[model samples]
Target: MTQLIFINLPVADLNRSIAFYEAVGATKNPMFSDDTAACMVLSDVIHVMLLTHDKWRTFTDRAIPDAHASAQMLLCLSRDSRDAVDAVVAQAGAAGGTADPNKPQDYGFMYGRSYADPDGHIWETMWMDPAAVAAGPEAFAAHELTPV
Candidate 1:
């Protein structure tokens, strides 16, 4: 099979996490979900496995980090436009998320803003133009995210 992505993450409360993901526009997959975990379908090939803290720990011997104190992952979603980014962040806020205390990053062709989910998972909503990517990451240094 071709390589696909399945991001596994721990959630303190499965039902609560499910609600948050739904608010962020993700659909639920019954095939891989039950009382212990919920599979959030981002795309046909991309799945986010939201597991209970206990179930998640079974996958590894390592202790689960305190997500609120330290970011365990930075989940990013690309949008079609700047407005789309704003809409998604607004939706997240309405769903009990908080905007990251940082200025927006504008690299001429790409722009991004960050937010934290209720469980403190970091998420960056971004809009990147192909033309800008071709210009290279260096192109953004001049238009770096300056604080307001």
Candidate 2:
């Protein structure tokens, strides 16, 4: 079977969290979801499991940190173009998330933007030229991409 990644997050409100994820392009996987947890599919290999505090405690005893006041881990999702990155971030904001929690990044060959979910989880959307990536970081270090 192909390797997959499931990012589990503790959410304050289950239904609202589900709506937030769907607005950002993920689809709910009912098979793995329940009243206390939801499985959101981002891609074939990427899934997000949103769990309530009570349910989260069943997995571990770690205290649920306030994501709004503390930084957990930054999560990034790649997009096909700069516009796509912008679109996702915009969609997130329209759906009640905070857009541009951090400054946008534009390096000629790449672009990125970020948003914070209602629960304060930060998700970054980025786009990089495929050819530039194939050429490797060494190539980029040699010279900056010419502005298009």
For each candidate, what TM-score against the reference? 0.85, 0.94
- CA lDDT of 44 in candidate 2? 100
Candidate 2, residues 1-148: lDDT per residue as tens digits? 9999999999999999999999999999999999999999999999999999999999998899999999889999999999899899999999999999988888777888899999999998899889889999875796564432
- Per-residue CA lDDT of model 1 for 1-148, tens digit only, reads 8777898988888898898888988899999999999999977777888999889888999988887888656878789898888887888888887875346777657778887767777888899887767888776665656533
For model 2 the TM-score comes to: 0.94
lDDT of each: 0.82, 0.93
- lDDT (Cα, 0-100) at 22 in candidate 2: 98
Instruction: Note the residue pairs that clash in candidate 2.
Output: none
Instruction: Give the clash count for model 1.
Output: 0
